[model samples]
Every structure is written in structure tokens, then in C-alpha cells.
Target: MDVTPVMSSASTPATGTTGSLAAMAQQAWGALSYAARTVGVPAGVRGLAVEVAYTAVHLSVYPWGLLDEALRPGGVHAHHRTDSLPPYERSRLVSDLDGSSTPVLLVHGIVDNRSIFHYLARTLRRRGHGTVQAVNYSPLTAFTGDIRTAARDLGDHVERLCAVSGVDRVHIVGHSLGGLISRYYVQRLGGDARVDTLVTLGTPHRGSAIAHLLPPTLVPRQLQPGSDLLRELEEPAPDCRTRFLAVWSRMDQLIIPQRNARLEHPDLDVENVRLEHVGHMAMTIDPEVVHLVACRLGRTRSPRDRIAPVAAAG
Candidate 1:
């Protein structure tokens, strides 16, 4: 089977390898328990249990679900094939972009691939941006683990794209965890030089209370604030060419305290839109959020561009 992701304007990239064997085991246990409860004991249950147990045993070998890519000749996982695209797809993308440097990269959130950006990318393309590339990465792995790797990978991709497309820099639009991942890339991995704009929709910048409410075994502790992942996100870095914008909603269920959506960087440009009655995931593909991102992307100014008016008025 082709394990590579389809090269959609909205497909996730390949996943990085995982490190936590214990966490994988715990996730397996929970899945098994849920399956047993759903089916109950009987001949049916026994048959299902056998399948479930078989799956559990294999989960250790394939945490990210690649049959052989995650093991053997691995430190970084091997690249696999996607049913959607041939290896030469990158060449075709260059041709599609027509050698013009469109200044946008869309990265999706946890458990989501580029598909989350399908509607938004199509709309933006209609608006006449030069080119758009989606960062596709698996989410089952730890945020700090695979995500960090993803950020680095993105940096490499950006370099290659710039070289091929003759674009000096690209704007970045991220939704939910994608936003966080984008921030990490720009701020920590020195992606600021290659990116011009950073727009985050429904990102949880300060960590989520909903994450805290979940059982520790069910979700990694690193998801909480003060954890390694959050701490890395909070670390200070030198300024770059990238401008920042964040679109927040009042009713984001996933981002508890809602204020978690706020960007802490005083140096980066920040904007907040009050999205009423919109949930976290909904904002990813919301038309209003997409408009806000496009508008922000079109602006060329310092991060402090609009701060004086609010401060003087306050």
C-alpha cells in the first residue's frame, strides 16, 4: 500500500518517528477498553478481542501507522508513497505555480493534514496569490517530538521552494496546532528570514485548560503549560522579517480560558477578531478567518504598525 500522503493543496506531510513507548502502550490500552465496552462479551466479543489484541501488539511497531517506515533503517522514518502523487509531483507543482513566487504556506493542525486548508487555499488562489504549499505532518506523535521535526523539515522545504520558485520569502498561515507549529518554526528554527507573514487562526498559544482536564494517561503531559512543548514555544528569539496576526473566537471550546489564543510576543504584529459562536475547528475553515488572513498577508508593515493608536487611545 502507498503510505505516502497525497499531494493535495491540503494534505499532511509524512510523520516523524515517535519516542514514547509507554505512551503508545497507554493509548493502546484505552483503545482496547473502549472497543471491549462497545462490543461486550460473547463469541462476537472474543472474535473482536482477537483483532483488537492483534492491533495492540502491532501498535508498538507502528505508532504512526506506517508498516515498515517507522522501524529498521530508521532514525528519521523513510519516505513512503502516496496514492495521490508521483515522486515528480514537486516538479509539476513548480510548473503549476508558473515560476511565480506566491507568498503563502498553509499548515494544518493536529490530526489534520493539508485537507483542512482546501477551501481556504482555493479561495486564496482565486484571489491571485502566486503559489501556496501545504505542510503535511502526522499528529499522532507528540507535539514536541514530531512537530519539532516537522518545523525543521518545513524550513528545508521553504529553502527548496524559494530556490525553485524564485520567491524571496513566503507568508505563513496556520490553524490550531498548525499555528503553534508555524510559530515554533519561525521563532525557534530561524524560519523568520524565509517567511514574510504569520497568521494563526484559533491557535492555543498559552496552553489549553481542556488539555489539563484530560486524563494524564490519555494525553501527554507535555500538552500542558510549563511542559517542554509550551516552554519551547514561549522562549524568546531575535526578531525576523515575519509579521504576525492571530484570529481568535470567543466560543472556542478547545481553547479554554479563551485567552490562550493571545500571542505573547510584544514585538510581533497581533490582531484579534471576535468570532462569535464559532468553535475551534470551525474557525480553521471559516470564511471570515480566511478573509482576515488574506488581508493581513497583503499588508506590508512592522509588527508594531497598529499599536500606537490603541495605546494612545487607552
Candidate 2:
């Protein structure tokens, strides 16, 4: 399949900042009050039930934390002990290259494991960007802690993989909460040194409506709006060495108010692109998202090359 990498226009107009704080605060308060009022009344019982059921099935079948010590492109589900899949080794773009192909690290969001990017990994590998790695985490833990720990683990995994592959640094692509984690790694944990590029798909950088809707006890208070993590991302930081591409979907059902899905930063190099049809989950499976990732991986063959999703249609 032919792939043309999509690049947002260079003219990245500054997103409006007027009343953003008040609006966000209002949303946060409303969500908090709603959760408070409906503490045990089953706030969105259907969504909660579906979320619980999906996780139960995944944990029962694919528990990987017990056996796997490393993360790879097509590694077994972190929840279930299984074999790690090799890096995507058949990129149409890098098939002819020697031993310097750039690696891509894939991470999933809350309540999810590495399987989220299975389709994307397979497609990118077929296109010749075979050095893909996926990170898995336990969903029951606090989301903030999970992101911090995952980044540290992922950095180590990248270093070890690079030693074996002879590639210095790799690209990072995160979905939903994963994206926020990647940002934390870069902003606070100094992950920019190890990553060449960062691509975030449907990440709720500013916080989410669903999080707001969840009862306070079920959701960690630290991850809520105005939390320490979001505060860090809000502050201006030096331009990271890693190029960033943020892909968002207008139809996101989980990220309430959808617009909060995109991160607005003043001192950063980024491309904010919006995809209309895909929802939060569809980002991992959609072909358009796959193609975009392939193009990024192909162009970023070496650490020197820097470059950087979608709706839910399953």
C-alpha cells in the first residue's frame, strides 16, 4: 500500500487561551460535584460496567508481568505471560538499510495493555519500520504513578534495545493516558534525551471528561484537573529535542468535550492535527493512523532524522 505522510500546515495558529482556565476549572468543578453527588448512584453505570468487563477478560487471558522482563514491538500482552514479538522488521522504507533503523516505542493508555497497537505495529513492520516496541502496565494502580514508572521502565528498555539494535534513540507514540505519560517522561523525567520524536494519539493532556465523571474514590485525585501532573505540563519548558506530532479525533467519546484532548503549549515544537472520523479506541486500529505512523518511522531512520490518528471506527 502506498503511504503519504500527512503534515499539518507550518502555520500553527495559536489556539485561543481566553477564559480557558475558567472554562477548564468549571468543567473540573462540575465533574467533581457530579461525582460527589452521585458517589454510589452509578455515575454512567454502562460505561463503568463495560470498562470493568473489558479489563477482566484481558487480565484473565494475557498476564505478562509475571514472565516478560523486556518490552518490544510486538511483545506479548503485559497482563498475560507470553513471548515478546520481534521488532517490526519489514518496513518498505527501511528494508534495504543496514543496521541503523530507528526504533519506535508504542505505549497504551489506562486500563489497557500492549495489544492496543497490534494492528499499527503489524502495518508499520510491513512497511519496513520493524523496530517497534510496546509497553504494558497494570491498570489497577494510580494513573499518575503508572505513567512515571512506565517511562522509567521504557527508557531502560530503549537503552537495552539500542545496545542490541545499534540504534541510539527511538520514536515514541502514545495513546490516551499514554500520551500524557510520554509528556511527563519528557517534561519531568528527562525522556527527551532518549526519544527522537513523540506522537500522541487522542491523549487527554489537559484532563478528561470521563475522568471528571468517575467517582472521586475510583479515580485518583492527583490525576484530576489542576493536579500536579497537569500543572507541570502547563508550565512553559524549553523546546525539546524530540519533534512532536499530536493527532486528535473530533469524535472522541471517552475524552468528554473532545477539545481537551489536545495539549496547548507555548514553548514547544508541535503539530496539532485533527482527525474527524476516529474515536478514542479506533485510533489504534484505523488504517489512516497506521499510515501516518509508518511515514514517521520511515523518515526517522536514524536519530538524526526527526519527524512525527484518529477516530473510533472499528
Candidate 3:
């Protein structure tokens, strides 16, 4: 009976097993914490928090101004709340030009109406960048219809704006998908003849990975990396006369790997402006962005000035 020392395998832990289990437990806790901080919170609750913060700031800083802007006739709210207005009326609202001046067309991103340009338009107007207008297109249309169709529509608006403003060329500013539409019009649709300078904010020129997160609809598909539409857009535009200024933020939540917002065409005149800690939506409201846009609009520089493409600024 030599049963002196019998050690069970289950009783003795293997070498590094304790460390591995501890590491796994730590990883699990970290994942749980991250989920709690992000997806665990109700979307409505987050929205409400943002609204509450905005309301508080509005009331505390400029209560009367906010009320007037909201309630007054032909005010921000009245003008932006154009859902009931006819298509012609909306277009007219955008194309209203008082005198002969360099027209600035504002194009908003996907799923957004022209109302998003309210603050930016006002800022441009105040900065004396006369005749600022915004164009609205359907997000569903972008999904169902080809992007070229949207470009054609934008071209039509540009032509109308130029005709009304008595200007042969207009400066275009677009955000997100609007920027893509503008570029298509300028490069592929021979819109460079009509557009002098093209400014884009938070645009995805190289396509965006975030598009994959969206439904596999037409627009999203077109916006994904290496899409046919994007490939066509990336083609050389040697004769394009438009000067491009691409403005992007480092912390843009929508444009995945934010550098996608930059324009990298070799044959075209493209400049990149980097913004710090600015969100995609805030790009339209930020004073610095407004000032940059105003300065670019204020002066009429020759296209040759942009011959050295790929200029960068902070």
C-alpha cells in the first residue's frame, strides 16, 4: 500500500493559469464598463440631456434674443421650419438675391434639411459675404436615387442662383454628403465653369467606413470605401477650375478615421484645414469656421494661387 502522495490535477493550478484568468476577468470588466458608458444609456436620455444643457445656456446667456429668434416673424425658426412650404417656395427662399454680389450656396449633409445652415448663413451674411443660400434635398432620395441625380439637382440650383445673382460663378460650401454632391457637380458634371471656390466641411472625400454601419441602401453603398461612385469621383479632374478648401475636425464623430474628410486630388487645387475638438455638427456653428469661410469668400483669389495643391492649416 504505497499511496503516499497522490496529487489531483484539478487541485493544482497550471502555471500562468491564475494570471490568464485574472487578465480575462479584467477584460470582461473593462468591456462591461465601456458598454455601460456608451450603449447602455438610453438615446432619448442623452438627447434630453443635450437639450437641457442647450436650453440652460440659451436662457442664461441671451434669453430675449433666443425668444425673439424663435417667435419673431421671418425669424430663424420661421425660415427654417419650411416643411410646409412648397418646393418652389423653398428654392425661392434660398435663391433670394437682393443685389449683384458673389453668391454663396450652402449645401447640407444627408438626412438634414437646409435648416442646418441657419447659423452659418447668418454668420456669412454678417461678414458681408453677400447672398448666402442653402439647398435642401431628401435623404431618402439619396438612398433611392443615384448621386448623379443629386448633383444634377445641385447644378440646377447653382445655375439658378447664378442667373438670379447676376454672377457667372458662385462659391459653394457643402457639408458631408453635400460636399460629395458638390464635387460631383464641379468635377464630373462640368460645374467648375459655374463654381469658383468649393469649400467642404466634414466631407468624406475618400469614402467613410461609417457608411457600413448604415443600412445597405444605395446612398450608403455609394458612400462606402471603394464604391463605384467614389472611384469615379476620385478620377483625375485635370481641367477642373474650382479651388477646393476641405475643412475637417479631429473629433468628428460621424466621419470615421476623420482624415477621410480631406480632399487628396492631385490635379485639382485642394487645401485642408484641421480643426481640434470640433464635432461634425459643430463645424457649422463654430465661430472659427465661420470666420475662415468669411475670409475665403471675402477675397477673390486667382485659381493659380492654389497651384500648389494640398495646403494645410489649423
Clashes of each: 10, 23, 0
Decreasing TM-score order of the candidates: 3, 2, 1
Tell me how far the alpha carbon of residue 289 in candidate 3 is from the true structure, in angstroms, after superposition.
0.9
Which tens-of-lDDT digit does each residue in 155-254 have in candidate 3?
Answer: 9988877776667788999988999999999999989888878999999888888999987878888888889999998788876768899999765667
**Candidate 1: which stretches are off by over 4 Å?**
1-100, 142-144, 213-220, 300-314
Q: What is candidate 2's lDDT per residue for 1-314, written digit by digit as tens?
A: 54333344444323334467668999899867654443334534433454456446546645553234344333522212112333443334345463225677787887777766766876765565546667776666443355567667767776776776676677889988878778778777777776777889998877775676554643354356666668867886764666678888765667766677777887676878786656567677667777886676555534334322001211
Best candidate according to lDDT: 3
Q: Candidate 1 or 2, higher TM-score?
A: 2
TM-score of each prediction: 0.60, 0.66, 0.67
lDDT tens digits, residue span 196-260, model 1: 77888888888786677755632246446566777877666644456688887655656766768
Give model 2's TM-score versus the native structure: 0.66
Query: Higher TM-score: candidate 1 or 3?
Result: 3
Local lDDT at 39 for model 2: 35
